[model samples]
Structure formats: C-alpha cells, structure tokens
Target: MPFVYMLQCADGSYYTGSTIDLERRLSEHQFGQGAVYTRDRRPVALVWHAEFDRIDEAFGWEKRIQGWSRAKKRLLIEGRYAELAGWSARQRACRERDG
Candidate 1:
C-alpha cells in the first residue's frame, strides 16, 4: 500500500509527502536525510497518515493536502473535522469579501 503522510516539524510547521515505505521514510526524516525542507527541520513526527491502494491516489492527495492552508492542515492532523469545515467556511467568506 502507498501512504500519504503529514509530519510535524520540530519548529511546529508541517510537511506532507507520499511514500510506499512509511517506516523507512519517517526514519530518513528523523535522521535529517529526507527532503531538504525536512532535513533542516529534523526530528519530525508523523502527525497524520492514510493508506491507499494506488500510488497515484496517494500522490494526488499529497499534492492536494500540501496546497491546503495551515489551519486546515492542522485541523486534519488533529482530526478536527468540525474545525476544518469552519475554517473552510471562513476562508471562503474572506475570499468572497476580498475578491
């Protein structure tokens, strides 16, 4: 199975990626040998993850999640579906008002 994952960096920021080997990938991230973004932010912890049968599906969701707002991402990491909906609503309202 392919996995889509979110990592909470030591600096409290988040990173999203997809991989077929979650354990190995996470080990690399923790050891500062992962993506350049996570390399400097070593010792990251997995905050959220989902498994998919297809690499393409996992990769697509990884891309989509990376584009999300920080607040929404946090809601997802924390499994706060209610807060995510509210955040989405607020974002839409602000965009409509400004645009």
Candidate 2:
C-alpha cells in the first residue's frame, strides 16, 4: 500500500511525503538519504500517516497536507478530524479579514 505520511523533525517542523514502503522511506530519512528538507532536519519521527490504494492518491494527499497550517496538521496528527473543517473555516475567515 502507498501511504501519505507526516514526520515531525527534530527542529519541530513537519515534512510530508508519499511512499510505497513506509518503513524504508523512514529509514532513508533517518539516514539523510531522503528529501533534502528531511536530510537537513534529521532524527525525524513519524507523526501521522494514512494508507491509500494508489501512489498518485497518496501523493495527492501528501501535497495537500504539505500546504496545511501547523495547527491544522496538529489536529490531524492528534486524530481530531471533527475539528479540521472548523479550523479551515477559521483560517479562511482570517485570510479574508486580513486582506
């Protein structure tokens, strides 16, 4: 199964990715053989992940999650799906109010 995963780096930043082999990908990231972003922020820990039927689906989810706010991602990582839409609504309102 392909998966979309999020890792919390040692610096407290998040890295999102999609891979068919979750364990191998994580190992690569740990050893600095993964994405440069993860390489720079080594000693990452897997925080959230969802299995998908296809690679493209996982990749699509990866891209979407990568664009989310830290707060939104936190909601996800914490398994608070009910609050996600509310957070998005709040964010949209903030953007519109600021502009």
Candidate 3:
C-alpha cells in the first residue's frame, strides 16, 4: 500500500510526501535522511496521512497537497474538508486582488 503523509516541521512549516512504508519513511525524516527540505528541520512529526491502493494515487495526492496554502493544508490536517473550498476560493481571490 502507498500513503500520502504530512509532517509539521520544527519551524511550523508543513512537508508533504508519499511513501510505501510510512514508518520507515518517518524514521528517515526523524533522522535527517528523508528530504533535503526536512534535513535541517529535524524531528518532524506526522500530522496527517492517507492510504491509497496505488503508489501513483498517493504521489499525486502528495503533489497536490504540497501546492496547497498552509491554511488549506491545516484545514485538511484538521479534517475540516467543508472549509477547504471556501479557503481555496479566498486564497484565489486574494491572489487576484494582489495581482
């Protein structure tokens, strides 16, 4: 099985990734061998994860979440799916306004 996971880094940032073995991957992250982005942010904690039947699905989801805003990601981690779309729309509106 494959899984999409999120880690809350020490600096209050989120890192999203996919792995076949969550435990092994998490251990690697904890040990500073997982990702370059996480290497310096050691001691990351698993904040959220979802299992998938296929590796591609998990990877796709990981990529998608990686592009999300921190607020949207937090919404997901908090299981507040109902608020995601509204936040996403607000984000887009802010971007459009800023541009």
Clashing pairs in 3: none
Decreasing lDDT order of the candidates: 3, 2, 1
Alpha-carbon lDDT, every model: 0.91, 0.93, 0.94
| RMSD from true fold, candidate 1 | 2.9
Worst 10 residues of 2 by lDDT: 83-92
Tens digit of per-residue lDDT, candidate 1, span 1-99: 899999999899999999999999999999988899999887899999999999999999999999888989988988887766646657789978999
Pairs in clash, predicted candidate 1: none
The local distance difference test score of model 1 is: 0.91
TM-score of every model? 0.85, 0.89, 0.89
TM-score of 3: 0.89
- Enumerate residue pairs that collide in model 2: none
Candidate 1: worst-modelled 10 consecutive residues by lDDT: 82-91
Candidate scoring better on TM-score of 1 and 2: 2
